[model samples]
Target: MHTRDPHGCCYLLYSAVVPESRPAIPRPMERKILIEAGHRCAIPTCRATPVEIAHIDPWAKVLEHRPENLIALCPTCHTRYDRHEIDRQSMLAYKRQLQQLQNDSGHPTQPLIKSPYMISTLVIVDEHGIQVPNPFKLSEGSHNFECMATYVDGSSASYDPYWTCPLLDRRGKFILWAVLGRQRRSSVAISASMKHERYTELACWVFPPDGSERPPFNPCSAIGFDYSYFDSPTDE
Candidate 1:
C-alpha cells in the first residue's frame, strides 16, 4: 500500500514480504519526527507525558520521515500496543488525529533530550609519561619519616644535618609512602586524616634552600582517586 503523509513523504507498506526472523526492526527517522512533535503522548483522552517514541506507520511495514506517521507516546500506550490492544489501523488514525491537534495548538517544538557520556579520573603516569596497567594501593595513617637537617652544636651555629617529619593525605588520613623516583630515595609520605573537604592542589618543596624544587601532583591519581561514590547518573 502507498500513502502520502502530511509531510508530503511517500511510503509503501511493503514489509509484509519481509522474513519474520529479521534481526531487528528499523525506525531510524521515527525519533526525529517524535522530537519534532513535542514530547507529549499523541493519543487522545490519554494526554500522558511521553517517555517513548512510536511509529504511526509500523516500522515493519514502512520506512520514511512522514511527520504524520510518528507519535510521542508514554510507556503505557506503548505497552498497550505491544499487548495487541491497539491495532495498526487505529494507531494510524490516532497519529493523524494527534498531528491535527498539534497543528491546531501551534506547538510543535520538543524538549531536547541530552545524552551524556561517562569518564574516569583514576589515571596513573610514570616518568616516561606511560600509564600503569595495574592499580596500586595506599596505606592510611601518619607515616613517620626522617630527613637530614643540621643539629645545632654548643656554638649554636654548628649544625648536624637531618630532621624527622610527617605528611598528610587528601582525606587528612596519613598516607605512608609515595614513590617520586625509580630508586625511591626521595618520596612524599603522609600521615593522619585530611582536614580539608577537598585539596585543590598539591606541591612539594625541599627545605634549607626553601624553593630549590617544587612538583605539583594531580589529586585524581593521588590518594583521593577512590571515587566510588561519584556515580554518573547517565549510567545504564
Candidate 2:
C-alpha cells in the first residue's frame, strides 16, 4: 500500500508486488495518464492541482491495476480519501460532477477522473501521544505484522512495540508506529528474554482521545519529518 506523499504523488514501487507481472510504469504511460485525468482536482468545485493517483476503492480493499481504478487527485483529496473523510453527500456530488464533465468533454466513460494534486501535510504524533516530526524519515523501512492471538474482549492480538499501543485505524489519522522487526533487534531480544517466548514485533495505530470526535495522530505518527521520498506503512 502507498500513502499519498506530501506532494500527493506516490510512486507505487515498493508498494508493487509481482513486479514481473505489472512491471514499473514507464514515464510516457505516467504522463499520458496524468494528462488524461484533467490535470485538476477531482473533487467537485475543488480546483487544486492533482499530485497523486487516488484509488477510488481503498487500497486496503483491492489492489487496483487498471488506470480506471485510479484518479489523479490533489493531496487534499488523497488524504481525505486515505482517512475515509469524504462523507456520503460529498461522494455523491463528486460522482455526479465527474459524470457531467465526462459527458460534456466526450471523455471515455470510466469510474475515475483525473485532477490536479492538492494534499495537506499533517503533524504526526509519537508513542506518548505527543506530536513529533515525520519519523518515517528516521525509519529504514515499512513492516507489516499479523495477529497471532486474540482477546476475550474480541480485540485482535496484534500489537505495536514502537508506540506501546495496539493497531487501530481511527478515522483518517493513521496511527504511525515503528516497524519493530529486525530494526529493533535489541528491544525485541530484551522483550523476548523477559517473556522467554517467541513474541511478535511492536506496532501502533490511532486511538481517539476522550470526547474528541477525531482520532488524533498517534504521537509517533508523521509530524515534522519531510515526505520527499517515503512509502506507506505496510507489511512488505
lDDT of 1 by residue, 1-236 (tens): 89999999999877555454533324566655565546666554354675576665566676444556666777887777766666766566556554444454466643211100001122233333344322222234533222221111111111111121224676886432232321222334433333413222222222211223221111122223222233324456
TM-score of every candidate: 0.29, 0.30
Backbone clashes (count) for model 2? 36
**Ten consecutive residues with minimal summed lDDT in candidate 1?**
112-121
Report clashes for each candidate as comma-separated counts. Answer: 21, 36
State, as a TM-score between 0 and 1, how close model 2 is to the true structure: 0.30
**lDDT of predicted model 2:** 0.40
The lDDT for every candidate, in the order shown, is 0.40, 0.40
